[model samples]
Target chain A: MSNTQGNLNTTAEVGIVEDGGSFPPFDSTTYPSQLLWLVLSFGVFYWVMSKVVLPRIGGILEDRRDRIAGDMAEASRLKQETDEAIASYESALAEARKKATTMAHDARSKVKAETESARAAAEEQLAAKLSESEQSISKITAESLSHVGEIAAETTGELVKALIGGRAPAKAEVAKAVDAALK
Target chain B: MAGNSGNAIDPIHQFHISKIFPVEIGGVDFSFTNASLFMVVTVAVATLFLVLSTNRRGLVPSRAQLMAEMSYEFVAATLRGSAGNDGMRFFPLVFSLFMFVFVANMLGMFPYFFTVTSQIIVTFALAILVIGTVTIYGFFKHGAGFLKLFVPSGVPAGVIPLVSAIEVISFLSRPVSLSVRLFANMLAGHITLKVFAGFVVMLTGFGAVGVASAVLPLILTVAITALEFLVAFLQAYVFTVLTCMYLADALHPSH
Candidate 1:
């Protein structure tokens, strides 16, 4: 291992110092080319990044942000419209319910008034007919009593004539006698 | 051991610089090397991932788009948290640094790939850029008052100079620490992984007992590789966070 180490050291020294007369990294001969290339490549890279790539990416990000904001605004606006529609519909429903209740109340009151008036008219007509019927009944009763007195006077006259051979009482006196008995 | 003196067991060989296309501009060698290729590849991959994933711009993001957006938001939040809203002016630079370092580290995790952040020069250059921006912008924004960052308030008059001197020294050490932190982490992690792997190879060459014992280093190598992945991400985050804090000082230099 030591022998290998020694060999490795010698090989490294010869390769680094003798072949290039200096370490490759510290070699002055390669500086110009390295610098030249570094400047050129790095310059190009910077130019491309600043001028082209960065702006496009930034623009994409910005555009996405704006679109999201705009979409959110549109969504909220639609929600607001929907909310307003619901509120209006609810109010309209409440108004219609109120109107229906008022109409029902008015119809009930009108029906009740009409029914009361009809009942009163019917009772008044019944009362008038009943009074007329009572008057007729009393008149009929008086007429019937007069007839009965006449009948009775006839019967009596007949009987007396039979008994006494042809004597008949006057009708007026008979009717007066029946009236006093009826009273 | 005697036969194995090649670059295979040499851990440092992986960091070697070999030119693919040798270019000389006014007698200076600015050749495109493996390091350069990886840097370009890193940028390409990061750019492609970001661009292609976000091409659709789906409001509900796809997996790829989510990953990309998360990365962006993560860095953005970090920057905003550390430096406040005013510190967002440095977002591009901070994001670029983070992506570059992160992708570079991840790409280097593959076998036979160059780790760009492991290069001191590269990390140093990045650190210098950060510190440079902080210094320049601080001065430009606050004029001479930017120097007040070193002279914190509430110190007694006698202790003010001592406090300021210490503060100045600490402020200057920011770049050194920042650069070395990333570079050293990458360098040490890779070296350790390579050495363990080399140990596996060396042990395996010693017959049946060697092969049986090589499992320890092999397992350790695997674990270290996993740990390296974490370090890659952590280093990137650390670098960007520090960058934000430094930029905060630039924007408000009082304390």
Candidate 2:
């Protein structure tokens, strides 16, 4: 609406001249008319937006925001629970490992003690058997010494008989000699 | 009837207000003018656009619903950013202002369509509404303390009177500036476009050489058309931003 519309149009088929003068928008006469309609038009549009369209769109956005926030909160809670579960699981596994280690140590010690006691009992039985065998060997040797003295006295008596007629006196002396030899 | 080849090139002719029906009340001319027709048309089309687009209220949103949502968010964000969440109480008015002006400006770009916002009287009324609400609401909310808006902080006592006077003058001019900014932008862009189109029409009248030369204005007209579209959205944004700032000032009355 400039003031420079002086050269706009002087001839027209509609033959109207209201808009020909320096832009009719600047014309004070038309202000009331324009204002009346602008108010009516703006009022209706505002009513639609405030009372209808805006709220609808606003409601959808608000719903979407709330849903997303709820989902995120749930996800975080689940994650925290999962983390706790993992921690408890790990601790349980460590407890099992400690139990296994103590059980293995007890079993190893028990096996060693049993083997040591068995070995000690076997050694005591072997020592007693060895002493009995030594006693048998000494008894045989004493018996053989007594047998040698007796056999020598008999042989001396035989030799005296064959030598001449006085065998009885030689036998007594040979017996004494054989006995001393045995001693 | 006015679109005859002879008068088709008349740029100012499109702006004429013909009486579709004479409406006079008392001695005043309350006639329904051509401007009123387009104003009604603008509102109907904007309403239909929002209604049809958001009929479904789809969470996923159809194209029309998306557009409707965008328009809502555009003004919503502006209000929240400039005026804070409290300022959202005035969402209806600000959204109406932006959509009405934007649609009006866009409608005027078509042939034979009247640009409602091109009229200063119309834009001024809107500005007055905004500033008027701010003033009334500020006074009601803050009582006499709202007057402190004019007083600059950290000023010398001697210059306090002068600074406050200047501030008051600036505040008073708010409506004028607000209205004029939209009016001038729409008015100037339309005029430039008309001038270029008129050049094409005038040039083509001189035979082959004239028709060939008309291409220059044709190209410029096309270019300006693109620019005007951007201006349409920009002007509406600027208006809403200013309105939000004024409303914020009222709510808080902070300098």
Candidate 3:
């Protein structure tokens, strides 16, 4: 604690130069030797930073950009494929729909035509049958009248001849009676 | 102190740091010193450390590999915390500065070695380098609009000039503050340690009571030494963190 003379002298020696040297304000005069070296150091540091270190960082960033771009492109490509597939499916569906509708329409029209023609043919057959029935009825009526007429004529002729024979037994009455019977 | 008296205390100083070539434009006294040598040494050491740490190509992580990873993670964590993930880009500069300062500080603890960071010139150079880097990076990243750092956002237009002036003053003070912080901490701690050790030696030479009194300073000195060690690490951390913050500001000047 009381070793003042020695410690004080030693500590005092440190500032002796401080006061004598104007406290050295750290200007160019104080470090005149270091200027060139400082410039050189800075130059080297700047070069390395610009050339090696920064480039590596920039490269990493570029790689990330490339990766992102690639992924986006792949996604877009897949999306395009999906769109094309959907379009193809829709077109095929539309074509099938049109074909089915046409087929249905054609079938319906054919059925209608067939139905109309069949109805017309049936009407013609009915007309033919009606005409044939009318002809058969006429023939049957004609045959029945002729038979009645024949029977009446024969009975009348017979009655007349018997009267004439009974009444006048003459040769002239007998001859007329025989002629009537023969006619 | 007596063992190495015949040899000069510093050998690495022989390597030229900067040699002033004569310039007689306006009677300016320009000369170079050993400070440049240490700057070069710092760079070389930093380069060696980095290259060697990453030299071994092993996934299992050898000692150097582990050290390199730790160095990277240390700076990366600091940057991420201060400047968000954006700071990771500047990890090399921050990590190199931290290692350089840490190694320089530890080197001073060795006998007969110079403390580069203790010199105002060295610390100033480092601080100025950081400021210059951040300034350049900010402007480059944001172009001319980086001047917005001074005006900031959501400030009133009436006080724009005044606030901008103040902001400019503060911005200009960055290098001084950063350098002074490191220089003062190192200079003060070292001097205090030297002074206390002198007291211990001087008092121990006295009688029993003198020796007993030495214990107090000894304990205080030990505590201060431990604190000084923490400060050494802390100062380096603070410097790197501030550097990252400055870099972040430069990267996104609006922040």
Best by DockQ: 2
**Per-residue alpha-carbon lDDT of model 2 for A1-183, expressed as tens digits?**
222122223322333543345556777767777777778878888888889888878898898788889999999999999999999999999999999999999999999999999988998888888888888877888898778777878876666666765546565688998788767
Q: What Cα-based lDDT does every candidate model obtain?
A: 0.88, 0.84, 0.66
Instruction: Give the least accurate 10-residue stretch of model 2 chain B, judged by summed lDDT.
Output: B1-10
Cα misplacement distance, residue B35 of candidate 1 (Å):
0.7
Ranking by DockQ: 2, 1, 3
User: Model 3 residue A47 lDDT?
Assistant: 57
Per-candidate TM-score against the hidden true structure:
0.77, 0.82, 0.54
Which residue pairs collide, candidate 1?
none
Give the range where candidate 2 chain A is weakest over 10 consecutive residues by summed lDDT.
Answer: A1-10
- Residues A1-78 of candidate 1: C-alpha lDDT, one tens digit per residue: 355344435555555555654678877877888898888878888899889887877787788889999999999999
Model 3 residue B97 distance off true place after TM-score fit, in angstroms: 1.9
Query: What lDDT score is found at residue A8 in candidate 1?
Result: 39
Candidate 3 residue lDDT tens string, B161-237: 99999999999999999999988887777667666766777688799989999998888888878877887888888
Alpha-carbon shift of residue B119 in model 3 (angstroms): 1.7
